[model samples]
Target: MTGDTQSWRRAAPASPVTLDDVARRAGVSLATASRALGEHPHVAAATRARVREAAEALDYVASPEAARLAGGPTGRVAVLVPHPSRWFFGELIEGLEAALRAADLDLVLFRVGGPEERAAFFDRLPARRKVDAVVVLAVAVDDAEHARLASLGVDVVVAGGRVAPYPSVGIDDHGAGRQAMDHLLHLGHRRIGLIAVDDDARASAWRTALADAGIEPEDELATTVAWGGEGGAEGMARLLGLRTPPTAVFAHDDETALGAIRTLRRAGLRVPEDLSVIGVDDHPLAALTDLTTVAQPVREQGRRAGELVAAALRGDLQEPLAEVLPTRLVLRGTTSPPGAPR
Candidate 1:
């Protein structure tokens, strides 16, 4: 019971649906019937339709667990994430909850995962035994770790970043990163700086995006660590202390952006005059702070992930599919041309 654990476990069967019964009526292979019901990628549309037609004729019904045995399903799903405190997490939870509720299944939530705890999670195969699948949100894990998840036979879907052998759902982080940097560049910010999380996967992607944009050629790229505010403030302080300090800054997230803004103001700098700033995430605070940002479709991402999970649960789709949501630019008071004399 790690992430989003909910009620309705071991509930009495809602109705009974038999794969064998469907297969026999459809005159397809039993395995084909399973794939058709699960909507797996390899199964042909024609065969799937024929199988569904057979199933409808039989008035088939099934328990979640039973269907998983014959298809790619489990009665419960686990939503694994880092950083339990944030508006983003809340939005993600809403989508996951809605999906599970509709399917009459359970959702488990696990947060603040470490190597040992993660190992325990895999060993338990909770997602396989107690849940049908898992959704990982903006959390960092390696290819090896993802392989471990695959070995456990739990359907996995990631909402941020990417993992091997697992279909993912996310907006283009690189495009998002470029958008952030491009905003600063457009404002005539040659001395732009970055405040990023210390995640290898995410870090590499963001940095590459900045490089490709031809904004910061080499020494201009300064790296600093922060997943949220405190780290962001420290990073900003360091950047500001440089002899040729950046005139504009982009924090990886809203919290980090706010931190940079705070650090600059404390150093007797006038925002948008002495300093221009931007960040991703139009967190509620962004409007309050008047910070310009690129807003990802957060709740919408959650809703889509939820719907995808639900589709797999309801035998509507086969195998996990990757999805890309969009991001929007929200202009506010924080950004301006660098060194616009106040």
Candidate 2:
């Protein structure tokens, strides 16, 4: 007792401050303090400030692994696209990455396509416990696959197509299809051809639009093609060989539309003169080709989807939010009143 109790204590080995200590000091629940530190939106401003002050005072540091184990957001997002090589998916991913980076989140890419790959992906559900949320791009899955996807228990925001129980941000497919067809139909073209991706949701919308206009797309004028420039060229070739060729064409996308234009030129026909053309998606090359199109905010759709996921992570958006963005019809050199001077 005489030899200075201070020296005998040896500072009692300074204890590492834990989240529990911060919560105790802030007079809040452990969960509230955790949310405050994680910058979750559900925590009140005053509570967050108090929690932060307590953390600083206690020199408390949160373990990334521990936080995740405790049901906290992992600050990572997963993007599932049918084909990363495709222009639409590639551009969508770019927008999603930009938005995620701005929020200090990481992105994980999963390219799923074809029956085999999709089946395997849904079976594994690899994203479980790996990411905070998932963003699905334009890949339609059957009911069974949808059920499998939902079993992953991750918040999802879709970019191109709608899946139930999850919020989506995309153009209205029906409206977009009608806009494209109306442009061609109003241009005084009755015999209109359709070059669209086979089994795509847009195809159904296009059919409905054509039916509403009392223009039944006959077998000769309707061709279901694969998704790109090659398909466009091939589809156009088949349509041209028909006994009653169409004076105008409505391609599902701008890439296909551009391909159609090339085919028409190769046949020594002038665009909007020998035939009028219209398409969806104001793609990057649309301006160069002067392609008339229904312009949707493709990039914005991805960015907004990212924001929605981030909000979900912060516990700000509990209820599902479905957003259908607007699309505008852009007129250009590719389309005009049929039979206009070359």
Candidate 3:
């Protein structure tokens, strides 16, 4: 044998250097070492560097097969979606699928919309060990649900929304809301109303924008509904029943804006002539229907999220990242100055 081979054989330990040895040498917990080696974003940079240096000193090498058998990467990612049938979710899925496919990873979709469905999914997650990571698509994970995911020992990524302590890619909801509301305000529409699914950032923006414009937001002008077209239609009907209806309305999304227009048409009113309207998310149909809206890059958010998942799996993510894309106002035929001549 060569001299170097002989020296290596003499210096090598009787047994392989275990991860425990590296962790102990690095002065970190076992989990911290694993997370450091795995490139989890939550680990401190100094800790990761120390752990890596310890592994090098100990000549420790991680086994891929052993890691896989012990709940390591399976080349598949689990994607949790609230409303997969909706246009927004569909676009997200499309972009995510493309990026994951390019990275040679498979996507497993789970619909966790209702409370019962969410409960069941979280309750059974511990029993399932088929995925390397979980990607949440526009679903707000509660404290309990987040704990359940934490117990899974897998990385989590969020798309289209922000969840604490996890990497995410999305647009600024408050900014998008401002784009829609400010467009109406610039059109000289002082009496504006808001139709929202929830009192989220967008709703907050509505209130803030009105206050900044030196106008007090009326409680009667803000109406919350379920979601989608039907809920929007009902909200619009309620707004119309008010003593003084708004000269302009800001619906939560394009679908909601379309529903409001339906209500207006039923009342024999013309858009931008009798009243102006605006919304967020330039859905595909929004352009066809001439709905003015704040256009957000829904698909790009998904694609970026997929990239994050890939980076996490490859042990390259140095820190938790929250990437916010941009939103812009898209003026269409639906919005104009209040009582402006058509």
List model 1 lDDT by residue over 91-147, tens digit each. 777776776677665778877456776677666663445566678877766776666
Listed per candidate, the RMSD to the true structure in angstroms reads 12.0, 11.2, 8.4
**Stretches of candidate 2 exceeding 4 Å from the true structure:** 1-72, 125-128, 199-201
For model 2, how does the per-residue alpha-carbon lDDT over 130-239 read when each residue is reduced to its tens digit?
66667889876678877765555456778876776677888788788888888777878888888988756567766776777887757667898888888898889888
TM-score sort, best first: 3, 2, 1
Q: Per-residue error at 163 for model 3, in Å?
A: 0.3
Q: Residue 204 deviation, candidate 1, in Å?
A: 5.7
Ranking by lDDT: 3, 2, 1
Per-candidate TM-scores read 0.75, 0.77, 0.84
**Model 3 per-residue lDDT tens digits across residues 31-112:** 4567678775545677789989999999988876325323434678899998999999999999999999998889999999
Model number with the top TM-score: 3
Residue 338 of model 2: what lDDT?
76
Instruction: Give candidate 3 regions above 4 Å deviation.
Output: 1-52, 55-72
lDDT scores of the candidates, listed in order: 0.71, 0.78, 0.86
